[model samples]
Target: MISLRRQPMPSTRVLATRTNRKTRKPMQFRGASIAFTLILPVFLIAASAATQTGEEGSIELVDPKVLRVCADPRDLPFSNEAGEGFENKIAALLAQKLGKTLAYDYYPGATGFVRNTLNAHRCDLIIGMPQGDDIVQGTNPYYRTTYALVSKQGSGLETIDSLEDPRLKAKRIGIVAGTPPATNLAVNGLLGNIKSYPLVVDTRFDSPTSAMMEDLEGDRIDVAILWGPIAGYLAKHAKTPVKVTPLVKETSGPRMIYRIGMGVRHSDQEWKRLLNKLIAENQTEITHILAIYGVPLLDENNALLTQ
Candidate 1:
């Protein structure tokens, strides 16, 4: 959200010269044109200054003084600044290493958070950007996971591997709009038959997953595709005992495997490098962080990163 403004161009004047009747002085006109060219550099400098002024209060990661972080306020299991969520834990760890106070810019996990907050410099780092995404510069993935299709136990939809299975073609699958799992389903032409919801929903009960689980319990949707941690959590606590089936492969769909990583501005190479090093050094601690939230730690290639 760095604001930019264009500077006004320098004014130019035409010089009229009276020669012999119809003959005009080409040299005089050329000289005036050259003068305008000579003033162009000053205009360029002024434009740059204007741009800097517009971005005066914006956050910049190059500053070594503090580390500002952006996170979703309600996306638990991922982030919240109120001493909950895994991303908050990781951000604290990063701040501890950098010897700076952790400042958070909280926003709901919506489509605009990235463009409005993260890119605007409200925060210098985004804790859980999906790896390989081009919208933000992402670090090497620290964790990997597969989308899970959850259903009430013995619901006759158990042991499903692919969304394209004939049994699921007519069934309603609940998917969070704009998530990687939804995209995967769309790529495989499953979106037409799926029921989608915004990733962030108002809490109707204790955990955020309650509403979705209620829908499952009511038979509103035959199946639900959610991130691994969320699916696992619901499966562990649900009264109906939903089965969590990890999706590993599909022929024409989006890749079932995805890696999650931290995001920084592309210009913040130093910060990116430093965070990567920190992740590598604190592998064990990060594993513990994931375990706290029940996220599976996997190598960049989707293999297990820890025993």
Candidate 2:
């Protein structure tokens, strides 16, 4: 009965510095305008030896001795100051390729993520952003993923591929308030019937996906719908087996797939180009990293990532 936006979380402390903060090279998304409109806007952070020239039509200054990145301080599975998230692993891979060390500008993925970090010239990169994001120029997309339907193991729902499945008519499904999968549910005429979790949770400030999974496993909800990576990773981590079926089929409207890329200042075309080349040479390796974290990788046809 209610409607809302999309959200992308978890913790804390420490900073680093490297001498050579040089530019790096690079590559999203779906819908009929849906691809352009249903963007999954994420956050960025990290402080470093960089400053904007404050001049119009010029790129910001970066030290070249380090890879200054913007990221959430506590959002695990994605990123954190502890360098445990998959994004952290990939950022390190990129910095090593560039022959520089990693540094971070840390903040919550709240309202001011872009303006306070990347746009402020405090950090130079956001490891995971949608391809068509307007805030910063995006490099080549390193991964494509879709939404997922999560259910308990042996729940007899593992084989379901689309929300249009008739069995779902009686299920108490859980969905984050503002994500693409929720949109898909609505398009399929299921919105008014499912449980709507807030896109942002104030309780310990955890990710809404976490709460959704808890509800699903606890039997408070029969199923949970979330972004592919989040659902895949969490499902892999559950103490009891869970089924994470990628939502590959939609009858109509906005597609649930999205392409993720690194983001840089619009003036940083040289850096963007550098990342694009790196992504090409390391595509296989990058895919491996995502797989290690159980991120469900999909192609345009909704097939699994084989290589």
Candidate 3:
């Protein structure tokens, strides 16, 4: 889930902006440091030889001197041009660790995000992508999260844990159409009162997440179901406190949970290995960053890691 944060304005304003984004399936490998260590040295030597010889199959997809990231110029909770989002911070951290300058290829995260940027080789990495996304090879998952139910604190509905909760039946709900949660809402007989926002939009002009949050705050909608990271971060910054309950209890339909990872072109096996090592080494710091951003983190057991 990408939230385009236009700079200078607050997070609320930024999150309201929309751009096209898509989700993909899980990758075949999870990050395993031992595997990377055993194979990386050979891979690097081969790549180096290829580069020195100007070989056609050199493993040099990205520029060697800089860590170039493909990012949405206006996305928040993920990235923005001003370098104000967690992804920006994480990118900087990785660049510093790798002794490379941090650079970006700015594009709105609307349709063709992967095709226009990473596949085009305009940049080398995307800071936040779902693990196993087919469009690009994914690093080991750095964090896991889920869709959540959001409501103002003190609203009787705040405690409702699942779509099957009886209290939600009478409430007007706001949700992004076509997201995984929408399927659950439909099957649970709760779609009738929903105010569905467009799934794919150009963030430069419209922001469904912001619209939904505005409606939620204004009482236009009694509750909302949104991606956990977006809802968690926005709720933490909201003028009125909001409750974010991760939808881990859903028993049917597509799973609302996802593991997130960094993305690179599939052919960049060495790059992917390097990033996996970085992620493994910096897991603690990364968790701290996510917590500061109010990202709702979950352990492998589906238990919440942050309030």
Candidate 4:
């Protein structure tokens, strides 16, 4: 989890994107304000072309020949240097639809991700961002997802869906600290027997989701609550059968679901519109790619779109 903050639940972090340049020293996290160090590297599918700029206040803020994306190079199930994440696939799809070469500005999706990459003019697009993210303008949402509870088969915990289920009171749970689900656990008094993983880490070395899943598989933790994409993808690929129950029934705290969209510079309305069109026209293919990666897709009404 690179700690890409989402609004509404301001402390909620989205897991996504990059590769080893240098791992930053751990920074102190206080309240909801987090300070972090970032790694910088650019991956280009073609040589850099002249910036296609317009007069001041123009909406043309991108390079015409390349769809330059800001992405994390090591975070899998989302993105990685090998172009294996769902975001990477979607970026490639958009680039092809736009007749532009795909390029990437790789950086850890840590605190300064948008500030250093997209805002710095190093790239023009971010493949995945929570809708309504304040730092960058967001296009129309491409997919909706929710937090999910993951448990190994035969654990008898698969039947538990709501956080308010009484059987959960006696089981140990694993969760990423500071996520919206943490608040739900707190309100339900389930934090008492929980293991809290860090919200931010260098993806090159640390994977909170993988560690949590390992614990759950080993019976060290009875269940793990994680973001839908990560939980669903990993469970689908895990060695043994696993059950993923989307937590759509949370009646308190921040809502468990989110809409994800592409991000662009605030001034680049043209770029945003172009992306929205791409999303609309190729939505079927996009959904297919997500399904291949095991993302739990949802419709606007929070209903499941895929099994």
Q: What tens digits encode model 1's per-residue C-alpha lDDT throughout 95-214?
A: 897788888876544445566667776678987766766667888878777667888887888978777677877888887665556666776677777877653333322232456677
Q: Rank the candidates by lDDT, best first.
A: 3, 4, 2, 1
Local error of candidate 3 at residue 281 (angstroms) = 0.6
Candidate 3 lDDT by residue in tens digits, 1-307:
5544321111111222334344444234456787898999998898789867764325655568788998877667777778988999999999999888999987666546677788877789988877656767888999998889999988888788898887888999998876777888898998898999875565546778888999999999999888887887788878788899988998887777778888888787767888899999999988999999888899999999953
Candidate 2 lDDT, tens digit per residue, 112-196? 5666778877889988887676767889899998778888988888888888898888899998765656666777788767999
Candidate 4 regions off by >4 Å? Answer: 1-20, 23-59
Residue 227 deviation, candidate 2, in Å?
0.6
Task: At residue 251, give the lDDT of candidate 3.
Answer: 85
Whichever of 1 and 3 has more lDDT, that candidate is 3
Off-target runs (Cα >4 Å) in candidate 3 are 1-48, 51-58
lDDT of each: 0.64, 0.72, 0.78, 0.77
Selected candidate, larger TM-score, 1 vs 2: 2
Question: Which of 1 and 4 is the better model by lDDT?
Answer: 4
Model 2 scores a TM of 0.79
TM-score of 1: 0.67
* Model 1 worst lDDT run, 10 consecutive residues: 12-21
Q: Evaluated with TM-score, which candidate comes out highest? A: 4
Who is ahead in lDDT, 2 or 4?
4
Question: What lDDT, from 0 to 1, does candidate 4 have?
Answer: 0.77
